[model samples]
Target chain A: MSAGTDTRSVTRQVRPGESPAGPAAGPGKTPFSARLRRDWPLLVMAAPMLLLVTAFWWIPALGNVIAFQDYNPFTGGILGSPIIGFTNFAELFGDPQFLRAVVNTLGITAFQLVFYFPVPIALALLLNSVVSGKLRAFIQGVVYLPHFFSWVLVVAIFQQMFGGAGLIAQILRDHGYSGIDWMTNSDTFILLVTAETVWKDAGWGTIVFLAALSTIDQNLYEAAAVDGARRWRRMWHITLPGLRPVIVLLLILRLGDALNVGFEQFMLQRSAVGSKVSEVFDTFVYWSGLRTGDFGYGAAAGLFKGLVGLVLILVANKVAHALGERGVYSRS
Target chain B: MSRKKVSGLAPWEEPGSVAGRIGKGGVLALIVLAVLLPLYTIVLTSLSPAETVNRVGGLVLVPDGITFDAYRQIFSDSVVSRAVLVSTGVTLVGTAISLGVSVLGAYALSRPGTLFHRPMLFCVLLMFVFFPGLIPTYLMVTSLGLKDSYWSLILPSAVSAFNVVVLRAFFMNIPHELLDSARIDGAGEFRILWRIVLPLSKAVTAVIGLFYAVGYWNAWFNAMLYIDDTRKWPLALVLRSYVVDSNPLPTATVGVNGFGHVAPPTLAIKMAIVSIAVLPALLIYPFVQRHFTKGVIIGAIKG
Candidate 1:
């Protein structure tokens, strides 16, 4: 739906999440039982969702207390697991594989922030600058194709192109070039993953900026051009400023999720590149905990990731504040 | 679907240098080609007959001949066939469950004056910020006796908070007067939602539904965690084992011809499996793509 034009609703819309219902429901305290009786149908509607969320997300979230215990699902499961405070954490911090996972995760995150972040904005601008709406739409559709491909398929496609027996290797062999398989090359692993991310998501990423670009008043561009400003100057002054709010919001989100480069991308490629280069936090948890039956230790590793994520959220909030803007979680 | 456009550029914009136009065209062409060429090759490879694959001795790059033997072989293979059934069933059932719960729950919270609305919204919002660790979820699934069951694949991921919020945003945008009028006519909340709100919000609902459907279709990790039986493996897990793990399925290792036929080249069969995994997304995505930007813009505004 288009944004409302009413002045009263415009002010009210800013706090819709926190606001009482519109004029239909007045803001007055009522006894719980009375309201419950009146809203029983609505309560029934919400029951299933509440039940599912509790079972899966909230319960499992609390069950991370197993990270502190020596968990044996056969013995007592989450209920009676032996609590050995900090033992799993001790083991987690001490383990070389876990260390590698942390380092690799952060390294990839920082690398992607630098290399992969701007690509969508630039591509969106390029697409925006195109002169034919049909061509632009076709290009948009084509590029978003890979985002829908499951990571397994993405890796498979990448393997077909860059694996030892893949097209590139075959071409190189035809020219008598010795041994080149980019998929397994540890030295370029970061770049390889970054390329995969760009190929798969960069187009999909443009959707938000494209929406923002649409919101930018066309008059600003016209006025700037009328002032004898060339294209580059108009883009820098008007277009970039117009895009600032969205850019900041996404950046803050990207920071809060900084450690998550995604699991499937790394997990699928781990065998080819070896754990030494490919073991990220999620994969580390999967391999070390699930495969080896070290549930508590794996839970500890996963919990540590969550803790770091929380810290990142704080740092993101600080950045948001410094920019004189709302952070990721506020003003909802 | 649209009238031919003279230009996407605005009137105030110059035509720009010829080189700039060409460079932009060149880059856009390359981006489109990069996406399509790999897909083109895979589809070609999947269709290539044995001799053509043997001639190429790798991924088929050029089309010399065509056959559906690879698809026929995989379909005949019990493992791939079973997996396909599982994937399709899960996707449909999971999407329905997710969309059902999300719609009911979103409408419940859509009215801000509803009981427990703030707390419920806060609870759902927590999903974005916190993830239950993988081991705990596995343990919970097992404890619930859902391990190795089809329900395990569906239930754990049944609700998407983002979808719920987006739906709620759309629902709240619907004029409250309609609901009030329905209530005045003695229409209950359920009837109001069913008869009034749903028909108006079909596009957002479809977008959210597709999201759940695609997620379920592509899901493998949950299956890998919970399903120990190869018989229960979904198409994605099967794809992973066959292609990414390079493990051969029984059918892919044998010929589908009536008698004494050599198996299709592994490359062709592998590409065939890849093609099968990718085909659904390719088919369903374009129809839903245009509707999604609105869904996203709403989320951006509401979030």
Candidate 2:
């Protein structure tokens, strides 16, 4: 009886997603081909969708194969191109701008992770503590507005506020003080970009933390209060501990994405400041390929960046698992 | 989970300290004021007359005098106006396409243990971590002859992996029993998705759809990268040229409006352009406000 059951289960394992594969199904049941036959309409339903994704997403993904070739938009397609065999990679590594780009990308990511990461947590705590729901809602609306604005508009707003002919400069000139060049200043460009990111996104980031905070059983707070814990103590012990898992999860995710480091923001600013401090991987791709028309080299450089980011995410997710947090990719 | 059972000490409890309450109110007021001030300045500048704008040294905290000339010029049948229309069309079409693709894709992936499900899920997840970068993407678009085409804008961003993940999580949250019963009744995957999942998941669908719409609306980066035709240019890119680069008149030559009116100053035109770019999103936002909060919160947590 045991041997017969094992054969049935093995067949089910081999042909997954069928009725016979169901754990509850009896061993005496015929195969799930009949069930699948009835579900052909279901297969038909998924066909167009499968085709769409396969063509647009999967096919183009294969186009990344040009990273190894001497790709030319005018002359050769991804396949027809001559394989340069890591020559593009070699040229990329030797380029001074490439090195600068890597450093700049990492540097910006580090600064933002330090400065911008905790802001939403703090904002959520403040919002949670606020007594007036109306006031809190209004503030939430106001703060979230910036996140919806495009990077172009955000950068424009920054320029209007701080650019050479902007209001701040005019105010300073009226006071006989020198207009500070925040936009084009290479030294302060990183800070300016980071600040802009925070202004645009900090409020939006609060949504998850706020959601998690709201789920913190109110009774937990009450229980702490009953223990004579003051508001701050309750926040420190009950609230902070409740937010712990979320914080860890978000931190892991952020680390995984640490290499991204705000592509559009950097790209928009690159032209104004020149490429000294502004050169990052994305910009490098644009300048090298689109601007200079070196498609193969640019493809190789981009591929390199993607590979590094993938490694980071995988490692970070693995670390999260080891630490016993629910990482992004669960084993199940 | 009962709301009535969850009642607790009210926030307006007898003030633990009089000074503390006063301080809290003061701080709140200050924050409100600070946030409003920059937005006020932008609105005032946009509304102020050109003469007043100049007189105020572009620091018009309050409008010296109000005029809609800036708004008028933007809305008039100029290059700016055409760009606005182009942007509107692209955003609407792109958002619809993206949401449709993402909804179908997310539904399929959310089904655990379906044939080809895990591999496809892994593929989507890989796209998130390893962005194939700009050059390869650009090459692909160019090679496909999509450069300068509207598809350049719509196709590249049609299925954002982040949106897929969020929608999948939402699909996952739908009780398994409903799906089981539907399957037993011989409802096809798409039938079950449309009849059962889609109806129940409207909040998330609306929210994710809005996000795609907003992204498409706000997308100037792709335009900057791929689009070369000035006639096909979107409002945001046009705004960039006017506001960021301080470029003159943007191909209207003052004649595109048909009255042959002379172009305004670089600043006035720039402010006008900025207002044009921001106005639509602002208008459309209120309609989606109800779904916005819950949708965004769920999306973020899932992400």
Candidate 3:
């Protein structure tokens, strides 16, 4: 890919109609034809990625038209399928399983927001307070290790420690208590998954907050301390306020990603706990739509999730701006 | 409180009182223990003898005896060995291709006033807001004749817009005068990129490459969705089936004919598989650990 781009750029520069003088191109006022001639090499460099993104990202986006069609893969996919405006969505809305999935997604997302979100902030604060740099780095390294492990490995680790025949269960059994099926327990599965997420990601998440914390001016803390402010007072008045924008930015991003309550995690555990308790929107779309050959319905469910996420992000960004914070992207 | 000067402490930081020191120590100890204990159990259990593992009922925290039987059994099994090869191949090839495409695209996009620059930037940034739903993406993959192919795993996720954006930001930060000097010397865009831009941005490129490699290595979802043939499955998918899903490892038919009758303890095998899945990440983690904060901060703050 690199060689191809390199060759193309070199070849383009050697072509006719080349103006060798640099910056005399008059910036944005350059003629479109002249700019194209001069900059075609850059365009050539970008072509492969442009083609890939268009083919994969944009085409699939257009394929969302399947949600409005009774899409049968055998019947020529989206374009070939009969039009069924809102029927798939109506079915999705009417389906109890789909509703269950929506509820489960919301529940898991809420649990994560409430329980898992603050962990990194707390960890960052704790680590920030540490006087010894080496000790802090060591702790960060150890904690961050789990974040790289796949959900499969993480789930396996959790099962080994907590499953019916796992370490904890064996200890209980040895103490004359019956083993509990913690791994597959539906009633507590949400908690289990959330705990797993925290274990896997909390330490990794602290990196950004730690960065943000370090950027907080030392003079602010010094100024506060000069006024006879205590540690807790400084934290509340200076530290917390400094972290507020980042916290809000992350929170908004989290809300936008709420619909994605981890498909693979739930999919791997679904048969163990049964989908009745484990069905989040992603899994629901997979099982009901793709697996069952109900492509249109699955497309509708996924489309709904995506649209909600898009709206959530937009609203969150708007809210961030209202609060005088820079959201994810600027309007410009 | 005496306003005593303290060396090596920040202005707002307390010189640890005895109670405060003890409290910090306790918290750090808990954090360390929470992470280390589970890892210890996994390693110990993988090394423990079958009888010891069975005797303990599951994960062995304290091994009475050690054995490599589980590891030996898994490697000797064709399914697992093949899956390992598949994963390594996919990760290497996928990372290389992803990095190549990303570098080219990022370099181009980083240059201000390049043809279609704003629209291209807008398109990539818009990826942050919405994703094409699962079914459509799957359909697109199938329609492209990539279904059941390894390309399905690599292609769909080949270009991460975030990585491109991050790399673009890094490339843009490169001084224009350096590139202009090269350009004045008749060095083309490609030559300047190869000799100057790449060498200068090695750290960010490496970080982005690692991200791509990790993503590919850890991905089983694409395989699960695309590849139907069990033989073509990657190590992660196999690991998920045998370990996470609690399914028994498929008995090897060729190498150890009588091994089916006397299999290792299920728990030991599961632990071994778990360890195997995590081993690569653990091995490479230390080398890349320092870059995590640097790379992530660049992406987060800039993007």
Stretches of candidate 2 above 4 Å error?
A: A1-52, A73-76, A324-332, B1-35, B179-191, B250-265, B293-296, B299-303
On DockQ, the stronger of 1 and 2 is 1
**TM-score attained by model 1:** 0.93
Docking quality of model 3: it rates as acceptable
lDDT of 1 at A87: 89
**What is the alpha-carbon lDDT of model 1 when measured against the actual structure?**
0.80
- Tell me candidate 2's TM-score on chain B: 0.84
Q: Return the TM-score for each candidate structure.
A: 0.93, 0.87, 0.91
Native interface contacts retained, candidate 2: 0.33
Candidate 2 DockQ vs. native: 0.35
lDDT of 2 by residue, B3-107 (tens): 221233354222336566566667656656645566677777777766777777774786677777666776654677888888889988998888887887877
Q: Which candidate do you rate higher for lDDT, 2 or 3?
A: 3
The number of the candidate with the highest DockQ is: 1
> How high is the lDDT of residue B106 in model 3?
84
User: In model 1, which runs have C-alpha deviations exceeding 4 angstroms?
Assistant: A1-19, A22-28, A314-332, B1-8, B254-256, B259-261, B298-303
Clashing pairs in 1: A131-B8
DockQ category of candidate 1: medium
A97-128: candidate 3 lDDT, tens digit per residue? 99999899899889878888899899999998
The 10 consecutive residues of candidate 3 chain A with the worst lDDT sum are A1-10
Candidates' C-alpha lDDT: 0.80, 0.71, 0.79
